[model samples]
Target: MFRTENALILREVRFKESDRILTALTADAGKMTLAAHGALSKHSRIAAATQQLTYAELTLFEKNGRYTVREGVTKEGFPGLRQDLGKLALGSYFAECLEQYAGEDQPEPELMQLGLNSLYALSEGLGSCEKIKAAFELRLMTLEGYAPAEESCPVCGRGDIREPVFLPEEGQTVCRACRKAGRSLPLTENALAAMRHILHAPAKKLLAFRLTEEEQSLLSAVAESWLLHCSDRNFPTLAYYRNLKL
Candidate 1:
């Protein structure tokens, strides 16, 4: 049978001679691996379509419940990202995360939109990479039911949040008094405010918000802790970001 859909290139790996195994995040299918034979050769449509970070329309054939790309048409190629190494690595990391977290046969239309929007923003918005990463992580976790709450305290039943604490293990904030007795990642008032903004800010506001360097550092650390705690794997790309100091 024929299956036609839009897809985002999540990853691709060489398969045998002149073939590549492409992993794509699609509108109807979350993630899929397809073999494109001789795809790297000149004048191959599959080669053109399978580039990472490409948003393409694919015509596929499914036999025995496996999807194979018969042909593809490029709709949007995130070329600007390719020009900047940081953007490219960041995009690749996000693509890998999308592929790793979501698997084939579980469709998420909104997540697809978020991925596209982020790539577009990388091209069009101010190069505030930290904001973009945080925004995506915030919304991605939220969509996955992990976004932290903005309440006065997310721990110990109740407390007015004069100075909230971010507990990486808990994935939320706790009151200062409540935090003293519990395991937590310590955070300052300014960092707490930044976290609040990350939790509350709408999509369009991420690139616009002005965050201090110190706040960015704190937010980055907190986010890393949260992701590491949740994903259960060290994000080497994120570690690369940490080394870049931006």
Candidate 2:
């Protein structure tokens, strides 16, 4: 059967000399591995759409349980990200995280939208790279049911947590007065506020908040630590992105 879907090309590998194997996150079907015949050829019509980090509308043929690309049209190539190595590395890291967390054969429209929005924001320079990275990390972890409780200090029941420290393992915050001896990342007021915004903001306004350089650094650390704790694994792409920053 033939069907068309909007998908983000998360990763691609060469399959033989001219064909390609694509790992795509579809709007309706979650993640899928697709065979794209001749997609790697210099003259292939679908080459642009099948490249990693490109969002495309693809015509796919499915037989039994496998899929093959029949046609593809690139919708957003994110040219701005391509022009900057740092942005591109960060975008690639996002793609890798999506591949790891997104479920196959499940409808994940929210996740799909988050991926598209993040890429669009990065491509358009709507926010700083660090801001975007922190937002995406926290939001994606929330979507996957690992959201940290930032509403208040879990220990004191204080709605306003002054001088908060984030506990990655506990997935919540505690006021400095209530913090116990454990692994924790201290959060500046702005960093804590940014985390709340990222966790609760609407998709369109997820990246609307701003932060000072120090605050951004703190937020990024909290976000990454939370994600790494919840996911329980490291991503090579993430390491590469960090290396690029350094």
Candidate 3:
């Protein structure tokens, strides 16, 4: 059987000296690994189609639970991404999320749209990279059914959050009244509200979003804390982006 779809080459590796193994995040299929014959050769047609960060229509030859990518052509170059390190880092971060969280052959239409929209925003150097990144993380949390309780503290149902701290392992938010004395996550109300807004807003408007510098710093802290608590791994790309001067 043969399948075709708009896909991004998420990862690639050399195989057998002449062939390559490509892992793609597809619009329809969440993720798939395909064989690309001679992708490294001098006159390889598959090379262009399978370039990392290149969005393209991919044709795959499939049988016995595996796929070999046969042909492809570009749909969008996202040229702006290559021009800025910050944008590239953001792109890489999102791609990492796709690889780590999204399951294979389990279509996530919402995530696909999120990826497309985010890529566009990154390509254009949209003014709110921090906002966009925060929104994306919050949306991803929502998709996983772990969205923070924005209307009120997840534990005490308090309308006012004085010092809200999110406990990712427990997947809930705690308010000042309910906060344990030694809990290290002392997040500000500004951060919590900003995260809540991003989680609740429509995806199309995520990139156009803005946050005050104070709110931005707080939001970043909360987001970094949440993601670290959830994934329990250091995200080097994110660290690099944070250090980057605007």
Best by lDDT: 2
Please report the candidate that would top TM-score against the real structure. Answer: 2
Query: Over the full model, what C-alpha lDDT does candidate 3 score relative to the true structure?
Result: 0.74
Error in Å for residue 134 of model 3: 1.4
lDDT of 1 at 175: 75
lDDT of candidates 1 onward, in order: 0.75, 0.92, 0.74
C-alpha RMSD of candidate 3: 2.7
- Candidate 3 lDDT, tens digit per residue, 141-216? 6777767666766666777865777665565677767866554455577677667667877877664445677777
Task: Report how far off residue 7 is in candidate 1 (Å).
Answer: 0.4
TM-score of each: 0.87, 0.98, 0.85
In candidate 2, residue 207 scores what lDDT?
86
Clashing pairs in 3: none
Residue ranges of candidate 1 with Cα displaced over 4 Å: 155-160, 181-194, 200-208, 240-246
Query: lDDT tens string, model 2, 101-144?
Result: 99999998989999999999999999899889899999999999
Error of 3 at 199 (Å): 1.4
Query: In the order shown, what is each candidate's alpha-carbon RMSD?
Result: 2.6, 0.9, 2.7
